[model samples]
Target: MIRPNMERPTMKRREFLATTTALGALTLVTPGRLLAETPVAGGTLVWGHSETTQNLDMHQTGTASTSRVLQNIHNALVTVNSDMEVVPQLAESYEVSDDGLEYTFRLRAGVMFHDGSTLTSEDVKYSFERCADPETGATNFEVFNDVAGIETPDELTVIVRMTRPNAPFLARLAENGAGVVMPAGSGDIQGTTPVGAGPFRFIRREFGNEVVLERFDDYWDGPAHLERIIAREITEPTVRLTGLRTGELHMINDIPAERVAEVEGDASLQVLTWFPLNFDFLNFNHDLELFQDARVRRAFDLMIDKEMLLQGALWGQGETTASASFPNDAARNTDITQRGQDIAAARALLSEAGHPPGSLNVVFKVTTNYPYHVESAQIIAEWAREAGVNMTIEQLTWADWLSQVWVDRDFQMTMMNFFTIWEPDRLYFSLWHSTGGFNYRNINVPEIDALAEEARGTIDADARNALYRRIQDMVSEEALDVILWFRNGSIGARSEVAGLDTLVHPNGSNLNFHKVWLRS
Candidate 1:
């Protein structure tokens, strides 16, 4: 469903404009009238950027946090609405051929890039082609793998021919990587400069300090309300909280789990929450010798207490999950709530797998920086010990965790979280596809992969949902990955801020910034 954070009520458009205008007139008539009378249009919003993003190239990085910043300064051919449906953005509209292999998009007329260059179908063709190239190192290349070729008949029309029918093709176009569209003759703008048709224009970036964006008055969607937005990098939760408390920051993200109560109690601060499609779970590396046995995987799954983890570790902020896919997804199987903490069942399964008590050496990998990861790892390790399984915990930083542990599959199992979207097709296909880059070599049943292909090719919603349900059940029964919990997405904003809608989607990028304005 379309779950948006509604805790902060929205003001009527007429009332908001009246208040802003009155305040603007009053402030402008003061001693510093020049600054105040300037339409209340220009003000910098200081936002916290939690992590250090190495690359600003949207195609190179599919992480949500990075995408959130990129979307303001870049534009996609199409945009995903709050309901997870595709809406026209750069392309005014599109039509699918009867066979569903060809898609023709009509580009909006008179759209200009931030650099004053007119947008053309050639740029669209070049951008998609570049993203599909293997040398680009784009994490989202697989999304467009179905495209056999792209053709631009004229300046305003672009046609894409797919090798196979892809039902989720339009949704994929709304992804973050899809927003990185550039001019045709830009000549490798990835590492150097980024030009796009977006509401905001990039001015300057100070690494580790802040990123400044100025309003694009010539934006195709009409001028944005805010004049400038400054996204600052503040990794520490306490520092971010302090900034919000002292009025130094307009907005902050990734609120500390412990401070949820305090933030909610404050009258001057507003806490926005949404049920995101993100799922945190334990991923087993089947390539590892110890994790190869299905029985062993099942035994490990039974050894952990998910409910207790949600209560004690996550502080009830997360919901228990049975299916590897998101619970809210139409594809999820609600019937199977697999293996709770049953030490006897776990021990028997271990015996059946020929792994005697204390014989199995299982290493749990987690990032040292994430508090929830540390808590969950400690609890699971203890539970596994109780079930007579020898377990050890290994912690690493974010960079080391991704490169050495995650990429290499160096550990027996690792605690990882996926920031999924509302659609199950994207989540299921990405995590379970045999050739999926992020699958991390954990394909157990080829049948499930075949089912995924079948679902992708099917256009009917009911048929596709049925295929997804079967895949979910098959994966859960086989114990491919131990489903843990679904965490809520949250954002903290000052009381003066209005129209702050946040959702649980990755990066909280689905926010509607167009209607937001400062309260008088």
Candidate 2:
């Protein structure tokens, strides 16, 4: 894991923010070993969800907000732990073939789904098939690229044979959408309501306001400590803080960085801070003739300073980076320098692309789902205008953005921010591959495709990491996308809330409230 050990920083907030997710020191002022005390159950915990969930169908949704809540209501075949290792969750145990092509998973015995159906190998097979089905419109269809066949040897055992050796195939299964298992026919009706054999089960979603979940005593892993959890949507920072302070909320995730000191100073409130494996990036649609020129794309990237944007848009809550990989990742090419803000250089690039500064006019579309996305886009738009580039900002609601910008690929340019399970294959293959499942930007290049295939099949850790580094270098040098920063998150909670490690205080920021409890 990239998470650093907590230490109070001696530097200023902005400078310290760059040192090991720099915000880790914020937790020091929190009292009473919060979330480390003996667990107790039977209380309702209302937390402020950063955004509204698109849907409960985990496989079909692309947003982290959806997975954040679905994780509490669903179980995966395997899961990532605090240490970032792949371990069994729904599957009691699993075995892999030495050839790195076949896997055998034994489902936990006597597990029951929310609808009282017993979990069997069939359920696992059904989930994978549904996710792989193009008709299902799942976000993780590419995850099954190596699958030759899925077989159920018995009621409890599922065997998967790959068409070719896939080194990270097992690890990919631990990701939210790919690994999540539901009942045989659950895929048919997972939109408004979903069912699974987990510590919590779906109760109801009050549209844009909130989604509710209740404890499941029949869960194979045992019941969640809280009797109920309400994920209330409140995007405004001030409103969320008010709810938290007024005792209307037990916890608030993604607290604005400016309020970290205040939350930490309150004796009744505690802060939970960590570096989330998430990023904000600018994407250019290759289908658009304007973005087809690499020089034009580079010029757009050069117009704005990533550091300035980080502080302006996020209050310096994250680390600046140019590649899809995190700033501190080993695979990042450190030798390549991220260009500073220079209007002269940017205008020169536009001239080289045959579109002089005044000649370049484009539309930049962004989503309102994340306030930072709109804020950062506006910041950069002003910079581009100063560079003699005529730019317009068009904001869309989350649902419209998903269809117009993501699925339809109908926009010239856009900025996106998201979090998910991180690995070489998950990061590179899903975004840069010619026909990647999530290649919404239409980044189709022969070299990137070749390197992605090679890296996906390469088994040795050191060899594959080198290949991934090459991919990162190519993506950045070609300006496939402008990755501005890797986000660090802070969660504010009442001191009475404990067992956070069991919630989102773990790998990939995957949420599982089953293990967390409210101190009585």
Candidate 3:
């Protein structure tokens, strides 16, 4: 029932200029129909992606731009609900062994892929094998490391064996790309045009312009609310909002801080704001001799003025944060939040590092995909100059930034927001651990690796929280990464858009549109 949709509209430069914009997603809640106010389906949605997805391979793509769209086009053996709890999706039921080393999943019957094929345990085995293969290069490889082997006894039953007990193992299964299941031996097809058992199916892509998807009638959970979705690649925030305002687009994202008041006043637009699970931080290339010194790193960390950043870049829209860890456990102070909010400890630390004042000059690479990031970097550059550190801001397009800064690792320093993930291990183990699969910055501290590894194996909440607290202290004292603040995310849409209440995303970052319908 799935085929390349031929109805995609081609756009010229002037047409593109008028309709360009972006969309910001939010926390996952209940699956579709929870906000049932009586549904009216069947309409096209022109959703916005501030950046185009360079990697369509969900099994390996680390970027949110790719995974957001892929979320609608695929399903995994397990997924999360509105409570952010791991639940079954393609797998109707699952059980864990008492030893916590093996997981047995029973596949749901009649689950169909985009290519008109029924799902089987063999497909699950193939996908798991791909994650185990180092060649796949999945971002959250640490999560899959516990997976020792896969055993498929029958068409509907599959078992996953783990090397050790992992508390967050099931939760990680709800992550993007890493947990996605596709047809067996269709790895090549997934890298280009993916086929999965999602409520929607991929149609075509015009390379950095737009992606099209059609509703899957044979979906196991039933048909989706919307008939078609067009994810438009528009990098400019103003242009995106303009399209939303003019009714050329149904929804927009990444609303600029200055435009918040305007969107709130407009009766025709609906403003969605939430305190997202994310942090803005500066990433350093540890391979550089200058960053190898702990003192230099601390000096840069101390140079951050959180108040200035919140006001200047985010227009004081978010709360300031000094801690390196998420504030999930407040009772134990597991976050290890730096109570002494100081932005002027640089001079002494720089002196101790043996670097003469004004001897350091570095390029802070930032992505244009996120408007706030550029503003944040600009503000940071000003503070650096006061501390005798020369700073040059280097702006790169979203695709280029992903390749040069994230994939190629040719950048000296960069800044970005950590994507929304509920678990601390998902946040720290992949980025802070020395041998982490997604350790793009080349951070190689044996202590961080040891502490994070210790936390990963521990399932007890109290013990794990204690270990994470130590990791947080180490990250702050050593200045592993200069975390600036807790960011607030905003999403703007037209008044006519409905079913968004049903978009219970798994990782709190991707946009699932199965329940999102247009009001007729």
Candidate 4:
């Protein structure tokens, strides 16, 4: 196991926002207790996940299941810490040119890849260039579109020149796939074979069951204390909770809301809530004629009550919001008023959109796996009935939802959570920009796209925030999508597991195992 001999994290600043996530507050462990305790080495940490993952290739799929294991397998140039601040990981330090288009990164000398190969600037160049390559088909290729060129002046230095000044460029580099440095000239990145320079090395992956990784003894900083880390897929929540209670698993994620109290009551278990960085929303398929009318879209937003959905579906574990952006975000429009449940107003809008009684018929597509999606759909269908619209619910698997809604664009409305990235550009611009690769909803507002592009180039923080504020207002005014509640993420683990309660990342997917150790 590789351990980073880095500086201890500073006290969290009050400026730091309690971000969004699907998890709620934890009751068992405190940061002070974990820090004050002595760490013991050589124990295996077994984690339970709710879904099956195909491979460790983050470049292809950015799913949470893949990230939970891959973060220990790959090291990024920059990474976010528990305080939600971006810190250096692989690169020792970085500087931006005065022109704002060039970023120079100094690679750490002693870092080593999982294959026992020494880290060099060439590997860094290759890792990024591979993703930027048009032929590689990286899911986040759009993030690298501004890269004009990459130059490796020496074995320890690499410089990236962008075609335009992108203010969110550095934050984007800290993102999952964009941050990881892979081996140069390696075989297919997405294939079964895997290698990275993180704390743990890939031992084996038992498809649909678990992924096993052992500590790298020759790690640059030092060998990790834990002998092994196993990420197991236990799709059933009850089974996962049982595993933690029975001491079969050290940590588990995606704990059900009703189980929070039960876990808290157990002295042997701990529930750690992550910052809010997740939201479940109904994404309107703008390509469909049924959602083309602005009044019709607005009617859907007004008909359903966000507070009721939060209480009934989420079990009152989330916060309601009117804007598409995270409520804690600096750029979020605070003035935008939520339409609140107004059946009369919703009916008037529907009538204006020429959708009188029984004139509107649509299918609400949702997933049965995650929280709130199924429950929210059922409640939405009831609300739709009162608004003189026929909305039927159709539950599909995650894979089928991806193929049918994201790829085929065949759905009228689909419910999915936006596991937002830390940066506003990725969270908003990537999903709403006209040319955005992930823009599943056919939102092609030229004005909004222009503003989004403008914000990307604005180097000043205040200026960029103002631009995002306008964009959020525009998105809310148009009702392009329903802005649901921001969710809290939780980590259910045994009381013996330490260090994990201190770390926090957006979506709680980027689990850092280096600091994690079993208490003696």
- Best candidate according to lDDT: 2
Best by TM-score: 2
**Cα RMSD, each candidate:** 8.0, 5.2, 8.9, 4.3
Rank the models by lDDT, top first: 2, 4, 3, 1
> If scored against the real structure, what TM-score would every candidate get?
0.85, 0.93, 0.90, 0.91
Q: Tens-digit lDDT track for model 2 on 1-520?
A: 1111121101122332355545452343457673435678799999998777886798988888888888888888987655455778888888877676788888889999999999999999999999998899888888898899999989899999998878777677877689989999888789889898778989999877999999999888777789999999887778899999999998888887677777878888877777754887899999887787888888888898999999999888888876666444445566665678888988898888788767778889998778888888899989998888888899998778888988889898899876733565878888889888778999889998999888777766667778888887877788888878888767888877887654662444566788777886
What range of 10 consecutive residues in model 3 has the weakest lDDT sum? 1-10
For residues 436-455, write the lDDT of model 1, one tens digit per residue: 65676466578888887787
Report residue 351 deviation for candidate 3 (angstroms).
2.8
The segments of candidate 4 whose C-alpha lies over 4 angstroms from its true place after superposition are 1-14, 17-35, 82-84, 506-509
Candidate 4 per-residue C-alpha lDDT over 142-237 given as tens digits, one digit per residue, 9 for 90 to 100 = 778789999999999999998988877777777777768888887384457578888889998888689899999877768887889988988777
lDDT of 2 at 509: 56
Pairs that collide, model 1: 276-504
Model 4 TM: 0.91
lDDT at 133 for candidate 4? Answer: 74
Separately for all candidates shown, the number of backbone clashes (residues 3 or more apart, or on different chains) is 1, 2, 6, 16
